[model samples]
Target: MKKNLFRSSSLILLVILMNGCIRGYTPDVVLKKDGQPCISIPADEDFFRRQKEFNILGLDIFQTGVGELWSRHYLDSKDHYYVKNQQCLYFNYKFQTNILYDISFFSTEKGDEENRKSTKKVWMRYMRIIKKSDGTLQLLLDKEARDYY
Candidate 1:
């Protein structure tokens, strides 16, 4: 009986540890126009630090660049994140009327300057903003489109 109890406790501990490793948060998405979805992702220190991990662990390719041209022009100067609220990263899609889309975010790192710029432009073409019924926006990676690219 003691052996069985020990096994059960070990199993429970394993499950707890596994659960703790799973990291992700539901982003608040909002639609500002007919086809434009704005995604608000956590930009806190913890979230920012986990970007590489998140990209490696998730299906979507996560990178930062300047937002859409129109949105970039209207970004809030007072906010640290700028282009949106504090402690948040704003992702907006441009040319909603057209079937094709272009997305952007500000790069937070500077290593490998030339390579980063080339890769940044390539990845931008794969991202798209999707709006949910609840008025929140989602950032999605178009794997099919990426494959073609």
Candidate 2:
């Protein structure tokens, strides 16, 4: 019983510390009149640290990977291990339209070596912000869309 309590406390502490590290950043959105899906990098380091870990682990660990050598790299949101994208974001669903906005970042390290460090774009999943209305919004998850959006 005590052992389980300790584990839970430790996990809670770990989560709190992590939330502290990624708190100061807010992602940017650009509205294009034409309205088609577009993927682009955040153009700075603050966004890199804000990407929420999809399931396995947070992507901020890779912040070390964005050194002088790389400009931006491709991140496939479909991979679902690192991208901060969540399918059913509810906070601002009502205010949004059908157009999707792009949120981006990448890079990292492990032990004494680089994990997914890249100087050029690599194939990764895109974190998109699609509008709730406009009928143009299509879900990659299909039926699962109703649960969230």
Candidate 3:
């Protein structure tokens, strides 16, 4: 009985230790200096060639995928996060009840303008229009985000 208990405890301890050493916490990898999250907007080459029209209208372009992944540091523990390579575009359109679609992602009052601009480096892949009164979709910056994977 004593040997069995010791063996079980040892096995449990080894499992716990291995788990800790293996894949642990992952942080967020910020790929751009702008505060905008990266996403790939679906458009053809002509779309990019027509930057004058889109860019002037605040249209964003980019590729999609996790450029890298990392862990966010915490006081006691760490949290897993990722740097997604998706492009995001923001139009200078005002808030409209009818335009309140679910395919748009709104920007929150978090990072600064510089960070927001840096976020433009990365593009948004998809968008879920949040039903918030604010129509502004601010971007995230590169300096603000750190790359992991």
Candidate 4:
């Protein structure tokens, strides 16, 4: 009995020690001077070209994976975040009565106007994702979105 108890406890302690030594996954997040978490990737291309196809991918990513990252950061669901790829991305995902994701991918706010452009790089000021009545997903950037999903 004594031998069994000692062996079991030793094994448990060794497992615990090994687990602690393993590191947790840390996302590649850059902190702004104002303490905002942002993804530092290049935003050189257009917001939603190719008939709003890019917006659809972004929306799908947010729903599945990006949203998980946002939750892990403990950010407010209602509050939007930013990504600095020189273009500026003030983004947010809202899952209220209607799922809404508005990512200001081309413009910056009043405070960080000098860091980037205050006005939109493209004609469409905002990149919004929407679902069509046909049960298919689509992106609504502006008047042009009416033609696409």
Candidate 5:
């Protein structure tokens, strides 16, 4: 009975350890124009007006790729693992719009040599703010994206 219990515990521990390195999603932070929450990266009225001087703001494109240089150099190399150009996002936040912020997602790592390669899955976050009414800013996690908008 003791042996069986030890085996079960070991299995559970293994599962937990394996999942420890996995990357997850960032919750959405979106509010109506009525304004409930404040903005984290705040700007001024002139900042808003200038941003609207142009009808089309700008395009923010994010490209993610992975693989060793040598492996990717060849026509086909099965030795390496890769995740390339996984996602692309385009958005515009005009000054006239009532949106306080626009948020996107990305994944990254810090202080880990083993994670040097860009092969790991990541969620990149993009945020664009139109205006901020209140001086207070709060970080929130929700179904849309995770940020303080």
Candidate 6:
């Protein structure tokens, strides 16, 4: 009887540990320079595979000059933006009585020779992601231009 009880306890412990491993991992939300909550999503294989689709979606939603620039720039220099300490992309989403979603990408590098006074180069683009009634995510570029420093 004691042996059976010990086996049962061990089985239960194993199940609990396995459950944690099986669960999908979500990164923690962090604050941007502007104080908005952002959840970083790594630019892994999955993201690159869908890059074209995302750019088309952004262009279709934004339909503005700056939006066009963002779509082109993102695809061209995406690799340059990848940094170990920085997030490749981030989303800000909240669900309550109403739903709100936004996505942004930011990059900073050493300043160009022309801008010798400043030691860093920075740029950021923001867009809104809305959930359609059919449950699809739609993108919308913010009216504000990209912030550069």
- For residues 1-149, what per-residue lDDT tens digits would candidate 3 score against the true structure? 56655654564355346334322221122223332333323334224444221121123221123111111121121321222112233333332221111122212112323333322221222222222347543332232212211
| lDDT, model 4 | 0.31
Writing each residue's lDDT as its tens digit, candidate 6 over 18-125 gives 334323223223444443444443344134444321121011112122221223233243333333322424332232211222232322222222432222212223
Looking at candidate 4, the ten consecutive residues that score lowest on lDDT are 52-61
Residue 121 lDDT (model 1) = 14
lDDT of candidate 5? 0.29
Q: Flag regions of model 1 displaced more than 4 Å.
A: 1-33, 42-94, 107-125, 128-140, 145-149
TM-score of each: 0.27, 0.22, 0.16, 0.23, 0.20, 0.25
Candidate 6 global Cα RMSD: 19.4
Q: Where is model 2 more than 4 Å wrong at Cα?
A: 1-16, 20-22, 34-41, 46-149
Q: 1-149, model 4: which lDDT tens digit per residue?
A: 56655654564354346334322211122334443334323343326432211111121112211232222221233443444344223334332212332222222322343333222221112223445687544444334433333
User: Which 10 residues in a row give candidate 5 its minimum summed lDDT?
Assistant: 66-75
Give the alpha carbon lDDT tens digit for every residue of 23-96 in model 5: 53332334435434321111231243332111111122221121111101111223222211211222322222
Candidate numbers sorted by lDDT from highest down:
1, 6, 2, 4, 5, 3
Best by TM-score: 1
For candidate 6, list the clashing residue pairs, or say none: none
Model 5: residue 105 alpha-carbon error in angstroms: 3.4
Q: Flag the better candidate by TM-score, 3 or 5.
A: 5
Give the per-residue Cα lDDT of candidate 3 at 97: 22
- Predictions in order: lDDT: 0.35, 0.31, 0.27, 0.31, 0.29, 0.32
What's the C-alpha lDDT at position 66 in model 6? Answer: 22
Better of 1 and 5 by lDDT: 1
Better of 2 and 4 by TM-score: 4
